[model samples]
Target: MKEVLVGSACAIALALLAGCSAEQPAGPAPATRPLDPTAADLVARAGSYYADEQVLQDAEATLVHRCMTTRGFRRPPPAPAAPVSHDEEWRPDPAHRRTDGYGLARAGRGEPPDPYFVALAPAHQERYQRELVGDMARRATLDLPSGPQLSYPTTGCLAESRAQLYGDVMEATRVTSVTQDLHNTVYLAAQADPEYRRTLARWADCMKRRGHPYGSPQQARNALAAERRSAAPTAAQRHEVAVAVADAECAAEVALPGTFESLLRRHAELLPEAQRAELNRLATSRAAALRHARQVAQR
Candidate 1:
């Protein structure tokens, strides 16, 4: 009896050890952080953009569809219509005098608004009155400095608040492009002449006078260089030419599009193996040099 009882006790002990061997140690859980909308808003604000939720959310679906379908991804459904503020400065010269006012004071000066801006008669106008004023408030919150300078979010006129939760900074982001940025800026400046001439003509027709005004800055720079010598530019002027040329090259490259893979496949196959990138690099440099030379010649 005692031997049988001892054997049974040993069997139970072995079963207990087997169970222990099969057990595993528990690991620590992952750390989590809470959402901070204010901090997020501040970060979004730092991007130097401002717009109502209307604008960003308005483009959500269309943008997603275009972006994704082209890349072969599942696209989301479209968003609702954009929330429009009362003000629209892109309305042209008749309504708001002095175009975007360079974020200047709100005096409603020299303004003859479009005849079409009617808001369902009287009562709605008072409600939407805040709409335009609200836009002003949002822009004021942005604290834009007054000067004959570029507007905030430089590309478009502000339609609403300046802060975007998810802003479109293609213009801002393009500044970082490796081979494209510098050349593009120069390209824009180079082509700015006709614009300058046109603006000058318009301002002149308005009985205003400012040489090299209302057009491309090169008009101004060229005018400045005219004082020294038209044939030979100074070293400083040569440097300006270099910058303008580089910027122009970047712009031309930008206007010419197609992904590197697709574009290269079409043309690169025609080139010798060793000449692909080297050819590009040399051409880019030569173009920049020629622009600098032209500026010097103009000087």
Candidate 2:
């Protein structure tokens, strides 16, 4: 009986050990994979990693920009008019307007500004800067979402987003200014021969008044692109446009700078050798591109 009891206890112990071995024991929980980060985070990461990767990005951007520009990309024109400065009008300084507007224009010392010109005037820019800063302060103070009377934010959102938006708008304004200036200057350049300027301006102004609206070099160009995109022209229109384009190209081909060597020699004093070489290369490349585009357009 003693031997049998001992054997039974041993058997039970072996069974228990076997059960322990076969049964799985729990360990620490598996870690959760992190979630995908937000746009801001991704941008931040890109900025960090590619902070110095300007060469490739810059080169690509430049090429694309040149292509777009040659293809007649244009920003909108200058605001026809900007809002008057109510605050300035209220203060009622008689001389300020004369100085800010007429005086600077005549003196040629600084920019004579309405709302537009003051920003560029080195001398008076500070004054307008102060005014602008004050305006921004008021905007910021009134930036809350609760107002019933407020319109679209001239400066909207908060923090960086607001800053980015404001910057984009401001840049648009500056471009408009410069573009309009370019338009004006091109007119002035034409005015060097007054009879021609008068003739062209009269025709262009008539076109503008009739609501055609493509009044400047870039505008006419962009309009041509837009028109081409919308429809295939009628046979008569195509023939007329083709004839006009061919005439212009014939004139332009004759007007190409005398030669590459002449260009370098003439601009030798003002332009560096590398710059001249690059400019020549660019001009040659651009001419080739223009010829290619013209050929495609004709077909």
Candidate 3:
């Protein structure tokens, strides 16, 4: 079966693990804590902007489908809708937090193949793929401030749609890239903090008492992945649900999520001056993009 374990949240969890170690350090400084209201508001606004961007992307996809139809190619209808909150990265729903342990198992469930595309001739299928994403070799790379390069198609309906929506694809990519990097830095710092490690230990013990002996939520998720490797989709999902519930219960019992959120806030405050400046820029750019997305939606 295809690996479905590792959605956006799981990806973040994996990134966090990079900073974790066997030895715990001193507790976080009281003065450097993450419970600031202003910072929370900023993060909330940033998250809202990301949601707006998704709306714009969905609009662009629709435009691409229309363009493809105009070009005499058969376009499939959009895939069935799933729960939107399920895909959101950072925001954890308290009521459902324990249901998808880090969202890894949930991420692993592959989207069903589109029947329309499947019925198409192989040549048509190839054309559709090419037209949708374009040739990688022909794409342009945008160097991000976060020390990463993003490769995007310079030509194709997808590219055209993006250009129309954002006016400048590179600028859009730069803002989003920097924002992501800033967010990642916080996660890394949180994982490294001694307080976070202590909370994680408590969560681990809670999981252990529940018959899930895992070092961390990420570790538990990995075990689930290996365990479900040969299971049918339904069976795998059942297992994931059970594990996620337990994970959530453990997290709540230990107040890990609240502690983690506070740690992230504290770490975010400790970012280098240059990164903080970039985050401000991202906020400004995102605000502008939100306006543009609204305009696009209206049209």
Best by the TM-score measure? 3
Error of 2 at 125 (Å): 38
lDDT against true structure, model 2: 0.33
Candidate RMSDs in order: 23.2, 28.5, 17.6
- Candidate ranking (lDDT, best to worst): 3, 2, 1
For model 2, residues 1-299, the per-residue Cα lDDT tens digits are 55554556547768776532345789988653221222111112222222222222333233333433343433232232222232111022233332232111223346344554333557555543433333354442222111222222233222222223223433322222322332333333433444443433544555455444433333444455455446564533453244233322322333312222122222232333333343344333323333433343343
**Which candidate model has the greater lDDT, 1 or 2?**
2
Global lDDT of each candidate: 0.32, 0.33, 0.65
- TM-score, per-candidate, Cα-based: 0.19, 0.21, 0.69
Instruction: Give stretches of model 3 more than 4 Å off.
Output: 1-54, 74-81, 86-109, 135-137, 229-240
lDDT of 1 by residue, 1-299 (tens): 55554556546768886533444677786543221332122112211112423433444334434443443333344456543432211111221222221112222356556343352357655534444333433331121112122323322222221112123332222211212322332333433445433443443333223221323333434543443344443543544444333323322333311221122233333333333343344334323433433342332
Off by over 4 Å in 2: 1-153, 156-172, 191-233, 256-299
**Collision pairs in model 3:** 4-108, 5-104, 5-108, 6-104, 98-244, 98-248
Q: After superposition, how far is residue 6 of candidate 1 from its true place, in Å?
A: 99
lDDT of 1: 0.32
Ranking by TM-score: 3, 2, 1
